[model samples]
Target: MTLFTVDPATVTPAPFTDDDWAFTLLRCLASPSTEEYPPARLCGFLFLAPDRLRLYFGTEPDLPGTTAADVRPGGALTALLAALPSLLDEQRLTKTDTDDPHCSRVVDLTGW
Candidate 1:
């Protein structure tokens, strides 16, 4: 996997606090699907620091033998967000697993 760092200021809106930025990112990552765009299957995310976050995308569900692709260089947070849904729609990223908790547990962050 390719590791990179991004300044939170570039991706977040005004008020730029760490919690707010994280929330904004999570919301974007978990945005609902539309006819033109599919939902982003978020494997996970971690705040490495107040300014840095790491996001993981799951492997393509149809092609379990292939390694998951890395997020392309989008330069800004909005660009990254725009790219994600298409990636899932195109089968470059996995679909969200809504069944079979025994295979994997899904964490619901809405309550938090």
Candidate 2:
């Protein structure tokens, strides 16, 4: 299985809140496409974490290299939040006492 890990250090959590983080991956899943990304479909996970995440992507043929950067959050989560309410169940975040990590539900998007 391919692995796409997202370290909290990579994401500057200065904008959104921990509660609203779940929405980020959903955003990515809905419209996860950058200039370099191929027009392939994206489907993955919304793994919760107090800090980082692992966005697993299953790319189709003609596309080989898929990474965490390929996943989207804002738009994807919005759409999903509206549809899959059950996915938003409350879960304790994995916060480290040392540096108060951005406690939030993480999404691991795969294939977009």
Cα-based lDDT at residue 46, candidate 1: 56
The residue-by-residue lDDT of candidate 1 on 1-112, one tens digit each, is: 9989989878956655667666776776667445544334666665645655545555456333222223322236576566544443353233345353322323222211
The per-model lDDT (C-alpha) reads 0.48, 0.40
Candidate 2 lDDT, tens digit per residue, 1-112?
A: 9998999988877767644665555465556555555343344443435433444333445334332221233335555434332222212321123221222233233232
Supply the global lDDT for candidate 1: 0.48
Model 1: how far is 76 from its true place, Å? Answer: 4.0
TM-score of each predicted structure versus truth = 0.43, 0.31
TM-score of 1: 0.43
Judged by TM-score, which candidate is best?
A: 1
How high is the lDDT of residue 51 in model 2? Answer: 39
Q: How large is the C-alpha RMSD of every model relative to the true structure?
A: 14.2, 18.9
Weakest lDDT window of 10 consecutive positions for candidate 1: 103-112
